[model samples]
Target: MRSTGMRARSVPHDSRPVHARPRETEYRPRHPLDLARVVLPQRHGAGDPTMAAANGVIWRASRTPDGPATLALRAGAGGHVRAAAWGPGAEWALDQLPALCGADDDPTGFDAGAHPLVAEAHRRHPDLRIGRTDLVFDALVSAIIEQKVTGMQAFGAWRRIVAWYGERAPGPTPKPMFAPPTIEGWRRVPSWAWHRAGLEPPQSRTIVEAARRGDAIVRAAASAPDADGRERIFTSLRGVGVWTSAETRIRAFGDPDAVSVGDYHLAHHVGFVLTGSRVDDDGMLELLAPWAGQRQRVIRLLYASGIQEPRRGPRMHPEDHRDR
Candidate 1:
């Protein structure tokens, strides 16, 4: 592995204090891999406490199964991904590098040639791949915060919560960052803090509830036989609908077929791109049915194609509920 001389300070969260040190690893993918595309999507926003992409390097902080970790990944010569990690979970994070960088994703049956638009997108970004973090609870918490809110609203709340409750990420990062809160940490966040973070009752309540059942949810998500089975497990919980479940699955498992069926703009965006008309959820599903097993890939391609729905109205105004 190429050396960057990066080091980390381990934060003691377990009974035994982790020796403060840095761990490094490298991975070479067989196919082309767009480091930015695979990693940037995992970040909730530019200000996300747990993720950042800058200067051709991607930094991420997370609560892994083993413990908390901070990871930095950069693309090196010949499609190699160089990863350096810090904190107690550094080894675990290093072990997860391949999956996080899309090693497990296979786009074999996708027929980009079937659609001109898709073909164009595929040509433009042949290296694009869906990446799985395998951090189901983290994805679940972020998805819940995003429910019925604008991206800005959700991102702001996520950043605040992380800053307030999360631990400092152990690394020589460019910016001060924090690992996302542990399951117990999330559950312990006071209701007032959620209010201050701009999280409304429904979203906050759902997150706390989910955190309460975090272990079971994680197990079900990881052990599900198929995407549908996983969806069923997620939707069985309160406040987790198809949209939320799909979003979580997309990040947690790199599931190609999980479409955000009830998204505010996704259906219309798909319709405009595919047929130059606005479409409802049913219509979008119909249009995307041709690519049944790779529906999400189709959406990704459409998004990457730069074909957007024409604006006919002003954007939705953001709401502030801190005083309500």
Candidate 2:
């Protein structure tokens, strides 16, 4: 049943927050690009409260190192992306715009030559590039929430937690949205709140523990020499593992080689797409070994190919323990 309550007054698109004028930038990509494909992957789920897409504009709310910031991005002619940001961290977010839109992804050695599907997919979408948010703790927290759970369960928990604990975003967002809580805020999420959000005890504990040393973790990951260093940093946490590390890498650093080794469907998807049969994580690794540096890119290309392994059984219905 729809509510008959009065709706809040509408806000104009990207209207300046009362605090200050939006900091703006226009990015020109050297290669072909598709804004949605590059940016929307940053979203945890279709209903992610931190992000929204409407009228060809993508709006995002995030907690930057400086503070919470709202970013609005839209694609324009000639592979140009116009961005506007608001809040104290607006300048920081604007400075990160290029990397956020896949500027840091180097596809130089990715050989799509091995497989026809890979070749065709690469040819079809030359603009395909991995995007990164550069927010390590936030990405780690989201990845931890997703640990060992179905997408339905993880996304639902993420939505609830962020909407409840996060700060309301600045700027004229099309819909109400909020930024993820600060590092200290994550440490402060009560156990009752985690229970209400449908996050398991293990995941919540991991987030809190990680938050205790959040700055050190972020600094270590950022200063690490490569993906291996990041893996060490992430997996050192009691609750984090390879899957969570890979996911965090993909989101925060855009490590092209990072693969979620233990993902429920990833191995199957990769094997099915490349070998016409499902494979285990070991098999998937072997299959992807030929393109070690760009394995994740290959996986993304396979995804862009829109080919899926046919289902052999009924869908797994996730259990919701949340009280109504």
Candidate 3:
């Protein structure tokens, strides 16, 4: 738990070994909600050891100030979200369920009518809202792993590393899931282990560097006055740039205005969706300028539209750089 500052005691990446009665709670959203739009973005990959979705239930393992927590969230009838959590951080997890499911996202004054396509998308996905995990350190680590790589590579690296080093999630989850290691655990990961996990040295080093000041970093970002403040704090770290900062903001705090500026596919997709032609980052930003405060929300609506630039050639294959 956070102390006078944001300092936390030493602990494992997640829950303690002993099992106990899981904490439970229920949240009824003020607006429409769905696991796909909210919790799904937190998954590193389809087979992420940190998350599992089955039988209308979403299971997630996370690290909190108190400790490791495994949360099982199910959307029940009548817009209710029934949740059960296990581990020391269970209460913390339970308390943040509404934010996790987008209850805290305020889209007031956002004009979907700015563009015809955005309006249509907003109409179709009226329940769409940005979700936040509220775990800054965890978000930073994951964002570091994703830098300058194919999604397949990033996802595979995350899956392998978390499964190998992360703590086993508490409770009877649909599938065995793990939470990413504590800040110390992250530093302790051997160099060879990162190579084996398919993460580049630079990315691994960035994570280590960030973890060195993990608690302080979390405090700074969480307490930031606005998206700009978060960006400044995140970019101040070595090897972290706009893309990583934006991704962290989206996952950790659900900043609707944060856009991953250097993302390879984002500019292309945004340009195509808005102008029927792909554009560079500058062009994409220009098209998105109208919705300055809700750029990410507009992007989400674009994604929801299911339009993409056609692929005319073979998909790029993930490169394996491990010692054979």
Candidate that would win on lDDT: 2
Per-candidate RMSD, Å? 7.4, 5.4, 6.9
lDDT of 3 at 242: 85
Q: lDDT per model, in order?
A: 0.86, 0.87, 0.86
Q: Clashing residue pairs in candidate 1, if any?
A: none
Candidate with better lDDT, 2 vs 3: 2
The residue-by-residue lDDT of candidate 3 on 79-108, one tens digit each, is 789999998899999999899999889999
Cα-based TM-score, every candidate: 0.91, 0.92, 0.91
Q: Which stretches of candidate 2 lie over 4 Å from their true place?
A: 1-20, 317-324
Candidate 1's C-alpha runs over 4 A off are 1-20, 318-324
- What is the Å distance of residue 143 in model 1 from its true position? 0.4
Q: For residues 194-312, could you state the per-residue lDDT of candidate 2 as single tens digits?
A: 88788889899999999999999999999999999999988898888888999999999999998888777888899999999999889999999989899989999999999998878
Q: Write down the worst ten-residue block by lDDT for model 1.
A: 6-15
Alpha-carbon lDDT of model 1: 0.86
Model 3: what TM-score? 0.91
**Residue 130, model 3, lDDT:** 97
Candidate 1 residue lDDT tens string, 1-324: 933352222233332334466898888998899888888899999899899877988999998998879998999998899999998899999998889988888999888877799889999998889999999999999988988888888999999888778887888777777888889888988887798789989989989999999999999889999999999999998888888899999999999999987777788899999999999889999999889999999898999888777788898764422111
